[model samples]
Target: MIDPRRLRVLRALAEHGTVTAAARALYMSPSAASQQLAALEAEAGHALLERRGRTVRLTATGAVLAGHAARIAAQLEQAEADLAACSAGLAGEVTIAAFATAITEVVAPALPALRARAPEVRVRVKDAEGPASHRLLADGEVDVAVAVEHPGPLGVGDEQVLLHEPLYAEPFDVVLPQGHRLRADARVDLGALRDDPWITPWPGNPVHDVMVRACEEAGFRPRVACLSDDFRAVCALVAAGTGVSLVPRSALRGGLLGSASGGVVVRSVGGRRPTRRVFTAVRRGSQSHPLLRLALDGLRAQAASLAG
Candidate 1:
């Protein structure tokens, strides 16, 4: 019989593309990882990897075995989850990954309720973006992931082994200097800022994509004056009268606005407003685990409260 541990090592190698990387990910030394793969090859009676210069590629048999390995790992995880569900008490740690704002607005607010209802269940939180959080969920590194969904058709590659539950839709508001001409208006038109310099989130961020798309829909491209990953810094830049920006409403809460440049003012965008849908994702079969279910419920409740 093939050892499940060896199968896991093989799968990790396939995913990470190198022995050293796989070893680091799995918390093993390179020599031990190589030995495990050798043992796996002996069990299968075939070579599983082809080494060429500095990189390693999986052999045909390795690819086939790795696919089976993935299914086996998922099945084992589901079996464990099923067993956990049969227990009388809900007591376990659930690790969740989410972005910065969601951590404050969604996850943190739900903690009090979670503690009250399930004192035995502990929650661990990690800050991660959409793609990174999804990857962590797929790898079973996190029990749940809070991610942002943008506007567009889902691609074939977007299919995941996780279950998704929609939480809430958060609107984006324009942030401007107090002295800016549009600050006096109750609702600012995005097109009105066509010629104004913009301070935008870095590329590859979901918020940045939303901002760019919203501007394009308004019949103009944003003239980016600066790029920042931190929304607080973006707010400060706006307060400094450097450039205008769009920020999610959730970020404006929790003293973030109070600490920002006093010269900053927020206004809603007129017409169709840009919004990001926040969703919670969990591993397919583990969603029913008592601890995970409790956490999910708390997250849903918090989101509903925010929406209300």
Candidate 2:
């Protein structure tokens, strides 16, 4: 019989791509993780890993087994949820991984109501961006993840193991330096900013991708003047006349940059509106648990409030 614990190690190995990374996620030493894999291979009477120097790749049999392990993990979560339903009312801890804006605008705002309604339920929030949050969810590190819509390791095909729920969609606003030529316009034309230096998030960030794609569609590429992932820093640079930028409506609500009274102007873009869609994702088969359900409902309520 396959040991479920060792199978989890194999699943981690497959998800993380390196023994060291897998061990770090599992809170195990590298040697212990390797030992677990070796034991798993012994149980299967097959080589489950192809060692290449310090790195390793899952063998065909190992990959197949890892897939089964994921399904089994989901089933186990379902069993736990079923058991919890029988015990009592909502009373458990739920950890959420979210980006900066969601934490401030959505998750944090919903907490008070959750506390009032179910005082026994606890929530822990972790700050993480989209791709990172998905990894945390897949590794079973977070019970829920608030993420922007983007291509991630946990794609639509993994819906059987995960639940994707759309929370809200907010348009990106054009942020311009004070006294800029385009500030007089109600809706800033993207093409008009082609000549202006751009302040954008560092490459590989979802917001960065949005800026690039929007600019390309606008008939020119953005000439980057500064790169920062922090909206506060981005707004600060824009206020200092470093360059113009794109910011989400949610970030604006967080007061990253003050308002028109501050040394910057925020306006919507012309043509097709570019938006960032935020959503909450949870592990499949566990969404029905009372604690998770309450959390999800609270998040939905907060998102609705933002929309209103």
Which has the greatest lDDT?
Answer: 2
- Using all chains and alpha carbons, the TM-scores for the candidates as numbered come to 0.90, 0.95
Clashing pairs in 2: none
What TM-score does model 1 achieve against the real structure?
0.90
User: How does candidate 2 score on lDDT?
Assistant: 0.87
Per-residue lDDT tens digits for candidate 2, residues 1-308, read 78989988988888788899889989999999999999999999999999988889999998888888888888888899899989867788999999988998999999999999999988999999858888888788899999888754554225656788999999899998887988889998899889999999987788898889999999999999999988888988898998999999888875567543398988989998788888999887888877898999999999997773
lDDT tens digits, residue span 54-156, model 1: 7778999998898878777767768888899899988889999999889988899999999999889889999998577876776558999998884542221
Clashing pairs in 1: none
Task: State the displacement of the C-alpha of residue 126, model 2, in Å, after optimal TM-score superposition.
Answer: 0.9
Tell me the lDDT of model 2 at 127.
99
Where is model 2 more than 4 Å wrong at Cα? 152-160, 259-261
List lDDT for all candidates, in order: 0.85, 0.87
